[model samples]
Target: MLEVADIFRAHGPTWRRTVSLSLGQLKVMSAIEQCRSAALGGHVLRCSGCARTEIAYNSCRNRHCPKCQGSAARRWLEARQADLLPVGYYHVVFTLPAAISAIAWHNKTVIYGLLFDIAAQTLRTIAADPRHLGAQIGATLVLHTWGSALTHHPHVHGIVPGGGLSSGGERWIACRPGFFLPVRVLSRLFRRRFLEALTDAHRRGQLQFFGEHAALADRATFAQWLAPLRTCEWFVYAKRPFAGPQAVLAYLSRYTHRVAISNQRLLAFDERGVTFRWKDYRATGRTRYKTMTLQASEFMRRFLLHVLPAGFHRIRHYGLLANPVRRDNLAKVRDLLHVAPRFDPPSDDTVIQAQPVFICRHCGAPMIVIDIVARTAPIRAPPMSRGAT
Candidate 1:
């Protein structure tokens, strides 16, 4: 059983009584509790070699449920393998200034969308400049709203093909083997574009603030807040180029379908509270794994804060991979790279058939279910302790 199950089993009822009565948290609790358990159904497998039997429970398969992401990650990796191109890939991260995080929390849909737009536009615009790459770049951007400690830290992780087609489509602009775009320029352009969009949103009344950030509600106050942002160093960190296109797809496999936390990271749960390991960037030397204790209600609040609106996509494709012209552009790219178009055969393995389950937990030998545990009804209480009324 996962730590989340133990935590939920112990405190989940109290949380339902204290917090907003909603199905979301309940469903999450149910998924976490039933993960890797027969309650959600399973299979019985019998080994022929030794006549050993095993019972394996199925996973909830919920994206937000930590226990289910393992297989999801694997399946995603396999699918991405087909999209890999034989070219160098770049890892570019775009992060927003801290001040915007509050407003982003309130208007997640709008601001998150803006984050994607600005990042994509900044890259495409820079790459199109004749003095720079002067080409069209293809990339995938994934939005991550939480840091390791479950704080509201939003950023975009982009895996870009290092080289691209020239403006006239006559030649390719292959980036320097070790470099893609200059960080300084990318940072400047990214800051300018992002701030400009933010200012526009503020003017158009698309942003709202209250409580601690209420001062930002005033137009002049907001301008003052935005003024220092440009001078501040907006981070645009780029990792060394990946060996080739296969690496790009592989990198996406790790980040694209990821959730807030994973079962493996959970350490333990007890009567005091829940404890889990998280990365603390502030510390020096080896990054330390720290634990946090929270009341069940507080935990539920923090966890549910990350549930995105329905149908909002956290992963997006741009440039050559954009849906409208993906096939046509991919063909052109294959021709330019001198690689023959290879079609992937229909996959027979994607049909998630039931796995056989019939196994003994203590020994490898086959075991039969000889008994069933049934719930017993509560016994009627004898007349209440008679204190003469």
Candidate 2:
């Protein structure tokens, strides 16, 4: 399969000299290019049962790398397994308009942070209204910066349980069957809160502008630019509630650690440019599935556009799911619903067998590390010790 790393390794050096990239983007390119290659370090493993040996290279483990997210997602989901409730779960998405996305390209940390905060606030506020569900809800929100076509589309996918704890925390309050909050209400509230927050950020000079958006540096010009967005509908929608707890986990695994594109989608890579499958969401039926080809440089540009600012978290929990009180909150919720806790403490007499990190492909036996290879070092046999006759 053609991978993003292939494109990066082939074109990255020349492309690096042609365009101006941020420190973060450059680091991502370098990491992806060297991943699982001799450029990075590796370990030689010997199978205990047979005489087979293999070299296992280290992964880049960058969150945005297409090849690295599977294990990362699995590990994350394992940690979250105990937090799942027995109730239905809903998938809600809050998307920023094109106007805001343009500015976000210039002020990622500030604007993206605002998007997370404001979306969480919108969901909690609506769910807590006496006229609505009348309870406080928890959500796990994951930020996705690119659309199917690798265009700069900023949005958050929220996984929310169908209900929440009541005001007194004594009982569970479930939303109407087959429904969460109204999409219209969520959209309106999200738009107002986001615009208000954006204005405040501008006042505090927390935002930046470049190229044509440089005019936004002026207070009046920025305010006027945001006027139309206030009246327009911001895309906020809730998909059907998941079938069950297992279904929710399946969905989360696919979305949580996804990158701009995956290697499985690549069809070809040649002088004609890189070809890949992309979904045209605007179309329906089989027509929605289409192939696209972009110059290798453009493909790299679009891929790197999603490298997040350092230390900025793309996944966040809010309300009852917030890290500080998640354990207590989940305990209270499981009790209210009369569902058994997902985890039980293991007894001292129980024996736990840990899975081996590496297994030999030639023989069905565990592999043991025999030697280590330094980064950028030649992969030749290690030198013999002084008395090894």
lDDT of 2 by residue, 246-359 (tens): 999999999999999999999999999899999999999999999999999998888888889989999999999999999999999988888888887679998989988998
- Whose lDDT is greatest here? 2
| Candidate 1 weakest lDDT stretch, 10 residues | 375-384
Q: Report RMSD (Å) for each prediction in the order shown.
A: 7.0, 6.4
lDDT string, candidate 1, 1-389, tens digits: 45656666677665655555335445666677666665655566655445565566677776677667767777777766656667788899998878887678877877899989889888888888878788998878999888887778889999888888877666667887898888889899999988888888889998888788888978999999889897999988899998766666667767887887666777666666666778887886665667777665566567766766556888888997776877777678778889875655658876665543354555554545433333232111112223423
Candidate 2 minimal-lDDT segment of 10 residues: 377-386
TM-score of 1: 0.80
How many clashes show up in model 1? 12
So what's the TM-score on candidate 2?
0.95
Q: What residue pairs are clashing in model 2?
A: none
lDDT of each: 0.74, 0.90
Report the CA-based lDDT of candidate 2 relative to the real structure: 0.90
